[model samples]
Target: MANNDDKSQSKNKPFFEVQKVENEDGLGDIFFGVDDETTKFPDYVVDFKDEIEYFISVIQLLYGDTKSESLYKKYYERLFTIADLAFNSPQEKVKLAERSLHKLKSELTTSVGQRIRTKLLMDYLKLAIWPSIIAIIIVLLGDSVLTCVLAFLGKGTENIYISSLGLISIAAMAGGWISTATETRNLAFVDIVSVINNQRGILVRLIFINLFSIFAAILMIAGFLKINIGGLDSLQIVDSPTVALAFGFALGFLDKVFVDRVEAKLSKTEAK
Candidate 1:
């Protein structure tokens, strides 16, 4: 009688539980539980002794093993499914499909959904950055060298002094474009995009830079023509308009650099 009583008591003890997966019936079964927890980030998912142990720990957390797991799996599957459909669809249907997917994402409130969205955003940024990167490379190498070469060649022309100054101005314009291109490309990275775009609130600045470049190019062409029409030996610094233009441009550039540095510092303070 005592042995039977002891056996009954043991059976009634609370069982440590893992996950409830479908055994044979459409319902789940709880395997024996052993506790395991993870602290690492997504790039490194945690390893477990067994499925039962893993599920048990997950179940223990808020929205843990049960609802959270199901929610994540469902959202992740949905996100990928929608993405696949969007990609395979015709161009005309792409925007519509993306809207539909976005709606589906909005319905989700779980951590899993948030993570999936973050990944999607990163992918989008990677695509955006490529063009800006290419532009930067082209401006840095192509424009920089060409402007300098053109300016040096201007020395042999009739207005040698003026042409040289014009060439230097072109180089400065190239430098500004190179910086803009670089900044835009940097914005493609997920970590820095917001900061880059935020400070870019002044869209007019880009227009001004482009206009400056155009003006500089025009000046260089005019200076070259003037030099070829006159004799290089007769070229005088006092008569050169390029000198004033180059000086003004250089001063403006320095001012811009100073302002940008100050703004960056303020932004950092605000962030903190």
Candidate 2:
């Protein structure tokens, strides 16, 4: 019985020892050698509170020195944690997450208000990027596949098809950046007002983006019109204006699908 108890205790000792090592390693990674940078750890209990107060004071100072420093650091930390968890995360979201983290790290400092400003900027950037990237992928797919489908269906012009792809890329980027700006700044009349004084600016920019998208679409369509109208022999299919119209309508349908996704996100956010 005594020998059995000794063996059981020996087995438990290794397990507990391994757990303690793991916990220490985790703490060390989080602090990232900050323990070496600071002075000797205080001996007494009150020191922990004092250290926290000092850290807060440093953060406040940095925040004042930099633009949205505290917010930026917070955003950076949050996004960084997400990245760490999803290191093997799909390529689709990895770049976006990395960009946000990089922006915060590059723009922010640990000293004071700078971290806050950086955090805010990072979050704002994310709002613009996440949707825009998804939109870009959709636009790219719609342009490529839809164009090919239209051509097969006797409704596409090569010039128009190629131009649509380019136009969609530009439009998607614009929409993403603009939406991010509005979201990050929390726009006027929203629950969290991030852009308190830039209401007019936001509206003006949005108007310009919408007008620009229209112009780009027209330019692409016009380019298609310029393509040799005499190439009927090469394609061999009878070109019907109705077919062209139908193809245009199909593209519009894709746009509606994209809009629906945006609306759903908005609804979910509002509900939250």
Candidate 3:
């Protein structure tokens, strides 16, 4: 009982006390959060009690002593989105702050348009690995699924021509679905709000990716990847359009580690 009482007494000591000063004319501005009453917050700071500390901390962490109106507007928009989310977890705000800081640092030497494009590509490829695999499975399953479509249309599945009808439709749908779920994690409204809105460009790239993956899968399944082990053909695992789809999906998902970034650098070099 005494130990518990002592702990309670210690906690009763204020983390901070709101400061106020008295003058003959009136009372001075009261400080509610900071140690000193004169400490003022940036206009971008959100007023939510749950997030106020985090917002202030992030502002200080990112800007340090060098504050700017541009940063204020940026942080204001981001903080507003953080407070608007349904679930108020601090982790999301912290993650956003970290990424924003990193993005700002990386963009220091890049032109404005180039920086925007880079940021978009980075977000597009985030959390794409396993999701890409799932998308490939959907595409590969397309061939088998065509039989069901044929049966529904009163056609027999035994007819090879009928089962192969609308052959590429399933792969297209799988790519579309992958683009839809690329949210990655909770972020500010403006961050990834229209991640797939550039539909034509995205679809074109994904199509190329899918084609390349199919090509690579054929070689790999044929023992072309040069593994000397027996029974290690791609058909031993990735047999149909569904299985072959994995290679293309991997290409897109691993674009950062593969062709996309390589192409980007080559373009930059050519421009230079």
- Write the candidate numbers in order of decreasing TM-score: 3, 2, 1
Candidate 3 similarity to native, TM-score: 0.27
lDDT of 2 by residue, 1-272 (tens): 99998776543331100011112212111221222333433343233323223333333333333565555366434533534432323222333544554454433333323333345545535444554455456545755676778889999445444334334444544543545444544221121223322332444443444344444344435542221222422121123333333333323324444345445755877899
Every candidate's CA RMSD = 19.5, 19.1, 18.2
Tell me the tens digit of each residue's lDDT in model 1 across 5-116.
Answer: 8777554332222333444423233343323532222221112113223332232332334546665455445544444343333321334545665465345323333343
Top-TM-score structure, candidate number: 3
Count: clashes, candidate 1: 5
Off by over 4 Å in 1: 1-175, 182-191, 195-202, 207-245, 248-253, 258-272
* CA lDDT of every candidate: 0.40, 0.39, 0.42
Q: Which numbered prediction scores highest in lDDT against the true structure?
A: 3
Give candidate 3 regions above 4 Å deviation: 1-176, 184-197, 226-272
Model 3 worst lDDT run, 10 consecutive residues: 161-170
* Number of colliding residue pairs in each model: 5, 28, 5
Residue 148 lDDT (model 1):
70
The estimated TM-scores of all candidates read: 0.21, 0.26, 0.27
